[model samples]
Target chain A: MNALALGLRRARFETAVYFRQGDTVFFTFLFPVVMLTIFSVAFSSAGNFGTKPDGSGGITAAAFYLPGMIAAGILLSGVQNLAVDIAVERGDGTLKRLAGTPLPVLSYFVGKFLQVLATSALQIVLLLLVARIAFQVALPADASKWLTFVWVYLLGITTSAVLGIALSRVPRTGKSATAVIVPMVLVLQFISGVYLSFSQLPSWLQSFASVFPLKWLAQGMRSVFLPSTFETLEPGGSWDAAGTAAVLGVWLVVGVVAARLTFRWIRKDS
Target chain B: MSETEHVSVRDLRKTYGAFDAVDGISFDIGRGETFALLGPNGAGKSTTIEILEGYRDRTSGDVTVLGQDPGRAGRDWRGRIGMVLQSSGESGNVGVRELIAHFATFYPNPRDVDETIAAVGLTEKAGTRIRALSGGQRRRVDVALGVIGRPELLFLDEPTTGFDPEARHEFWSLIRLLKREGTTILLTTHYLDEAAQLGDRAGVVVGGRLVALGPVDEIGGQDSRIPVVRWVDAAGQREQRTTEPTALVAELHRSTGGEVRSLEVIRPSLEDVYLDLVAKHDSTATPTGVLA
Candidate 1:
């Protein structure tokens, strides 16, 4: 089979396994939505960021949390999921078996990339639906805003997935994959404006988080969902679309290079 | 090497720093022949097999599989070879048939998934998750996946380690079926009877070297195959190793001029010769390499 067909086949295989595991389903896909629901309920009466034109209510906690959750969802399904999954594959000898087969290395990555895309798409949709119907959060109102969302989403996930593949080598064994990966992902979520407002974080922390992609991803996502007036709340008092693009773009290249250097079908010491 | 040889290894050596895992071992396996590599736990069998499978890089050596250097072989080369690792924790969440069918697509031509499952006696558990199966059943799944690609050459690395006696018999029959289909197989096993039953030829590895290589019946040479004549008579207990055990026994009976006490002829089995070979090698203080 050609590379495309083989890659799609592998994607289907990975998706099947991903959905079957209850832990992955809950932690990677459903966790963000669940967190969104809890935050919306907990801060329902806190206040509003801005008021809708209809003046019924302003941007509720769900609206503010929506884009952040979407960004976090991208990271969870992309970097965290792939890192843990690939580490498990290596530990369990799946990579060794595939290495022995006619399967191309490019096709294997294609499978992982596509699986992340599919799962991330589902996660984003679920988060959007919950925010829209359950919590009355508004989506992007124009095609231009959506176009921005599209590029950001693609670049963010591609970078995250590559970094995850690169990070798979860090854990010595599959059983310790989550212990090694979750803490790093969680720390990024906190400082990257996923769990808090970027403008509210200390400038030092913002600068530290700026070096990573999650902060920029969340910022780019806010540009899509939030009204233009809300850009003033950003760290730079604007969305800085060029900055987000540049940072994520550089990380994408870096991630691909790192993955190439670190990825192994089997462990080195073995 | 001849054109019929599927695998050729010349002076293959794999070293980890100061220790040599496989030290200057050389052997060749012909097409459609079942060659067993018999050894103790740390006897460099897995290292040699991994080198042939292209799973590990050798420190220095010449090794080829399917007419290509496995170290530099491409996907096309990998497609012709199927590997069942010593212990594979694969297919934990996937169904037996599903994983088999998925792997089948990786080859140019693959066997029918259901047929391959049946060959491994996993038809009943085809829909069951691989992790849900018993140890032996899971091993059958490993075999199923290995053969699903219709490989020309198969590597069975201690394939039946966790099998029950009945499952081992079933596995042996499956191997026989594959051999009948003209698949060249390189098998590594600690089970001497398994090697004797399935192997056309066997190589006895000891101390990171190919100590003996020949047909199963002929391995360990004439000295190893010598029969023992034992008799408890006037000398109390006496045992002698000789090629002519029948003549020795007749002489004992005639010299006694009566019925001999505890007189018996003991022939050495493959296991006996293998044990003797390993023991002999161990006693020589050859500085055996430590296996991983």
Candidate 2:
């Protein structure tokens, strides 16, 4: 009956519903594992593709791609999945029906946030497992480093989910939702170092990527996983935890405020 | 507010830019009574219900549902009221039981989920996914969700809008069952038959105002309206409208030598009265203030 109790109950129901959705499960959990396995095996023998200062390849291809793949996993659960689902619900009038209930509108968002967190956690763990055993990439054995990875991963997922919620309000129909989400996600992945290292990308692309939070989140996540000696490969050859947190914090605030402003309980045309 | 009055509204006004959706309408619904807000499309019926449901804020007015102002009422007030919205599209993955049970947790005292499902005639589909159900069955699920908490006041907004005849009858029975359990119902529907059958008293809303309000039989003051007498005569058929139907019948009998063939006295039905009221209201209503 209390707000907290109601929120928790709704969150449990929402998570159950999400898990039952076959496509959501595939994209959130199975798709990342499948992609990780295929990519790691296919590029096993080749070294990492980013260029060294001496015009030679740097790390192994699997090592360079591990972070990118992890970033992709975060994208699948946090942005693509949440955006599409929210859009479909809005289009179908489910959100309006929920709004009519005694349940607070905030409870619905809490449920969605928790669902994304759980799915993203499962996804990150699966990605790391495949990276460790199949790709033979070494994970951080230090407790402090693992703690940093958890914190950065949580912050990234939270920021991306809020951003997804904000973006979903723009698309009024399900078809338009897909159209908007596909291009937006592809553009972010390209510019955010999910597909290639920032240094290897064109100069303009690297500078453009600086405007978004994804690039910083991926870079911060990699800093936690890679060795201290590999700091030079980072954006500024340093682990900028404070900067990453600041950018993510700003994005989180903006995303929530925008969502609150734009979110429609009932379709305007309807 | 009195103990007998379940809902009360005074000077209720809702404006959209330069237009008024519901302009200064006032009414009250008594406890355990079936009250109908009858109107055609765009008649501000939905707007009034939304304001009562706390889904929208009125531009200006005093409105109360179950003795509390919906705009300022918190969760406890909401729990005491049930609302069946115009449409619902629950997620495809959740089964009926799962969804119902989940909603039940929001209330301090909720009916048994299985019993609620049975009450809505959805027991057979309890384990089925919401997406797999047909429109009518899904509507039953919506009703089940609405009443699972056993609300003291229930708002049904065009509850049978998409139902087939048989489904509508079944839903009517379900509503009657709720009434039997002493739940107050506030219904809005375009179907005059639904209003006539379910409502003890109906209010005709026009041009953002309450044009008429009374029992179904007396709506439009039709009982006092001039009664029309019809009969088959040598000139094909004859008709006359008069307040004194007994005198007219006696005069007709005297003219026909006490054997008037196919003589029939006709009184206006609720639909006829409703149409006449709306027509009269429209002609007199300000062009800008039409409720719909």
The numbered model that scores best in lDDT is: 1
TM-score list, all predictions: 0.95, 0.89
Model 2 misplacement above 4 A: A27-31, A45-60, A227-229, A260-270, B222-227, B242-265, B283-292
lDDT tens readout by residue for model 2, B153-202: 99999888778998888889989989999999999988888988899899
Per-residue lDDT over B36-91 for candidate 1, one digit per residue giving the tens place of the 0 to 100 score:
99988787999999988887888887998999988788988888889898888774
Q: If candidate 1 were superposed on the true structure by all CA atoms, what would the RMSD be?
A: 3.4
Residue A185 displacement in candidate 2 (angstroms): 2.2
**What's the lDDT for residue B37 in model 2?**
95
Residue A80's lDDT within candidate 1 is: 95
